[model samples]
Target: MTTFDKVVELLVDAKDCEKDSIKLESTWADLSLDSLDTVELVMNLEDEFGIQLEMNESLKTVGDVVRAIDEGLEQK
Candidate 1:
């Protein structure tokens, strides 16, 4: 699967959201991801992608998460 797909899966799995319900441009708020869910999502994403996201690296939106995954994949 593509990095985007994997990222989406992480979000979907964490939030119990349907795959079709999430889009790349969908914001965290729009996705109804609570603070705890966001933290879990980030940690799961880091493990899935083998990249560590710093605590200060805020992922305020889905786009931000997608971009981070893209960059992380590039680094790998």
Candidate 2:
């Protein structure tokens, strides 16, 4: 699976939500993800992608997380 697909799967499993509900435009708040969840998601992403993400406040959307991981992968 692509990085985007993997990220979506992670989020879906983490939030206990349907895969169809996840979209690029979907925000953490929209997905009912709290601060703790966000941290856990970040950790999961780091482990899955084997990259350390510099936490940023601007990462509020699914697309942001995908882009961050994609960029991190490129750097690797």
Candidate 3:
């Protein structure tokens, strides 16, 4: 599966959301993801992708996460 697909799966599992409800461009606000859920999702992503997420860095959107993963893949 693609990174975006993995992200969707992570979010859906973390939030108990339906697959159809998750979209790559969807904002956290749109997904109604709480702060704790966001943290959990980020952690899951890090674990699944084998990439470290900087806690100090700001990630405001799903697209931002996708871009980060894409960059990480390039490094691998």
TM-score for each predicted model, relative to the true structure = 0.81, 0.94, 0.82
Candidate 1, lDDT over the whole model = 0.77
User: How well does candidate 2 score on lDDT at residue 8?
Assistant: 86
Candidate 1 Cα deviation (angstroms), residue 36: 1.1
For residues 28-47, write the lDDT of model 3, one tens digit per residue: 78888877777888888888
**Backbone clashes, candidate 3:** 0
**Model 2, CA-based lDDT:** 0.89
Q: What lDDT score is found at residue 27 in candidate 3?
A: 76
The residue-by-residue lDDT of candidate 1 on 1-76, one tens digit each, is: 8777877777666678879978877877788877878888888888877887753446777778878778877888
Please estimate how well model 3 matches the true structure, expressed as its whole-model Cα lDDT.
0.78
RMSD (Cα, Å) of model 2: 0.9
Evaluation by TM-score, superior candidate among 2 and 3: 2
The 10-residue segment of model 1 with minimum total lDDT is 53-62
Q: Residue 38, candidate 1: how far off, in angstroms?
A: 0.6
Tell me the spans in candidate 3 whose CA falls farther than 4 Å from its real position.
Answer: none
How far in Å is the alpha carbon of 66 misplaced in model 3? 1.4
